[model samples]
Target: MSAFPEFIPSKLSFHLDSRLVTAVAVAAALYYALYRLQKVKIHPNEPPIVASKIPFVGPLVGMVLDGGRHVKSIGLLNRDKPIFTLPVPGSRIYVVTDPALAAAVQRASKELSWTPLIPELTKRVMGLDADTVGVVAQNLDPEPDEPHGFLADLHDMVYAYLGPGESLNALSLAAARELGRQITAHAAQLEQQSETVDLLAWVQHFVTIGTAQYLYGPENPLARDPRLEQAFWDFDHGLGRLLLGFAPSLVARKPYRAREALVAGLEEYLSAGRHEVGAAPIVQRRIEIAHLHGFSVAATARSELSFLFAGIVNTATSTFWTVLQVCARPALLAAVRAELAAVVEETATGERRLSMEALKGACPTLHAVFLECLRVGSDSYTSRLVKNDMLLAGQWHLKAGSVVQIAGGVLHADPGIWGADADAFDPARFIRLGEGKVLPAAFRPFGGGKTLCPGRHFATHEILAFVAMIVLTFDLEAVHSDENISVPPKEDRVLPVHILEPRTDVFVKVRVRDARAVVVV
Candidate 1:
């Protein structure tokens, strides 16, 4: 007792320690109570809320960890239900899993509008300056009496130039011709010896060069400097961090630097009048519109970054998947080759030429393969901002300012909509229904409503043409121990993307056919 006297606790000290513990517990309980009180209350008229273990923090953490796939996880919780509410910190995202509800969302485009989100997207994604963003924001939703605003006019112009007609046909023919030239030139090199390449890398290289040359004319920045092509991809790789807008220069430094380089390249390209010569008519019209708005050349060039992204990124990714899927299956490859042969015509000079019209409209198996790839390979999200509190489908009341999302992955995988084998990669899914069947509402690879992708036709022609040339001209085999070609798993952590890229590269050995036939588009 005498040796340990200093370590002994007095009754008074014990009482004070107990009092402190009680006070801390009381404070924690009160704080938690207030936190629970602050959460949004679900009314009877609103969609049922998916409960989280940690209240306000769970959904936020899920999104932070899962990226675009978080919605799919939440969706799994209520697979039987069509729609449900997910509460994150300071926001509510209503996820629609049912195709019927998605159709309804499209019908309510004005009320659940994508226009309201454009200014924010421009500033964060396109890096547009405040004044330029302001120009884009004008007349986002013009009244009946008001003159049409920039957004409306831009939409009208895009439809005029990109919609089905001679203008779209001209653009398609240009891309097809350029891609055919690239493939033919590459085939000549492969004739002597087999070349091993990363399938995705090779696809990106050809697609970027060919598509950029067509859209921006011969003097396109990407074609002039190869480094800018890498820069654009680097920026694309780090897109998720850039989209979050949390001190991008520090957190996403590489992509930010790459973005700056692209902006400068485009600025120089526009200043030099390169776009004036052979650029696509739609691209030329876009420049004219920018000039009419009194936008500075720098800002106008920055705005073109969006156009570049829309045209190149998804198109290349989709092409990679299409080629991989077709090459990996010998039966599918044979079918594609046979179908393409029918459309390819032998010329007087012994050169073979493919008409874009026949390739797009006549190839049944090829078209089905294209549609199936989009259905299974895409993970796009269609988002709409609720303008005001309104009843959705006369049942669920969505609050003003909440975001509504329709995840393509979730919809595409629903067995109820796509049948029992929804998850399987079956190209025959479309062929079984009938050739030229209108795509169901459930197919959302291009998204839906007023924000449907305007470049869909051009992108389709490019992909179909590239795949047709590659499968017919060269023999591709996976460079691996296994005889069967292996398909890589997709990258799932990125958000706000139409296509989910392959996680790993599939290297293949390419050898040209012995006949050495030339293909002219």
Candidate 2:
């Protein structure tokens, strides 16, 4: 009863206790009144503001609690206004639901920019050092012929090498060949053991090994240590927390330790100069640029972790879902296999090969299925910071320094844009897209504009090749009869920067197909 010292002898203590009591009372009142503070004022011509029910902390709290659904909640108000503002603690985010407004923001490139955010995110999420962050921010938004930041140079280097040309083709060829080898060995082992395999785990392992083989080479750091594979996923899943300023080393110890451990392995790998030993052209050049920008060997390795994370995680997750979708539908599975089989040819020497070039365009249904899975399963946002006050799309004033969120979940499911079956899986959807009947903006699983994913082509080819290989040669089914293969439920808090991984483990019985099939040559 006397814990608070109601009869305190010290005046200063009494004063502090009284102030603390008032502070606690005010905090309680604010918490209780937040629900009633739902009407946010909107000035004429200003973007309509959606008052979050939780007062100052609403938007971020919603994100933490509901994932992409919170962004969609902001979108609910978009029906009345093409653009609306989501008020955060000290700032506002302009949410654009109308595709036309989204394109305007995309084209208004300079006024709304990814420049300021990218450096900050890199520093926070990737856990880059102060020197490295300086290097990354140095050339941010460079003038023509002016010195660009390490990131700008690095991005240019990535695009230059990943584009349609010798470099990209070489990387693709190496990756496809190595991936085939890994699949063949793994599938053979699976058939021999006739075991229950976690569908997502098998896919993640093969894809990581295959992708890492090309990025880091045969003596790859990840493959050398089996634990690193799971570590990568652990680190990826915790990215949102890291980005939200919950970045103390102990706050997210699991991912932080895993990431640092991987970085240490990468440092050890690079120390031996194995990156030059048959590394992808992209890898070699990225290392050069990192060194030019003053990154130490350890820093360069740490930076490459981003590439490894992106290359493996997104493609692997999508591939797992694509495989699941095909398995669940009989007609789609048969059609895809038929399309793939037709593309494979037997050689005089008795070896068969499916032309990678042919796979890119020949299998229309496979393309549709892959794209549809992405569209339906994707839940993310593409954000750009507002650099100046401007009239957006000739209406709606967006204040300077505010942020704009281009939500994929809302766009992908918009009935007006995608027709009545927008929410359903239609593998033939891209067929129409190919026919030029629909606007390209309607399908944005990989995002669009100046920020369009540079790894799209690489990722697409890799995913298709991997999915095609498994489905064509292996027969898979869920172990429990009651269990079914379908799009795994998404988590409550999926990150925009993440590839969609199933919320739970998907276990299946896998075996070699009895039907005659083409072998990867």
Candidate 1: where are CA atoms >4 Å away? 1-42, 143-145, 435-439, 514-521
Count backbone overlaps in model 2: 2
Q: Give the whole-model CA lDDT for all candidates, comma-separated.
A: 0.81, 0.78
Write candidate 2's Cα lDDT for 72-148 as tens digits.
Answer: 86785466667787777667888877778778878888788887887778877778888877777786777678988
RMSD of 1: 2.6
Candidate 2, superposed: residue stretches over 4 Å from native: 1-43, 481-486, 514-521
Worst 10 residues of 2 by lDDT: 512-521
Best by TM-score: 1
Error of 1 at 252 (Å): 0.8
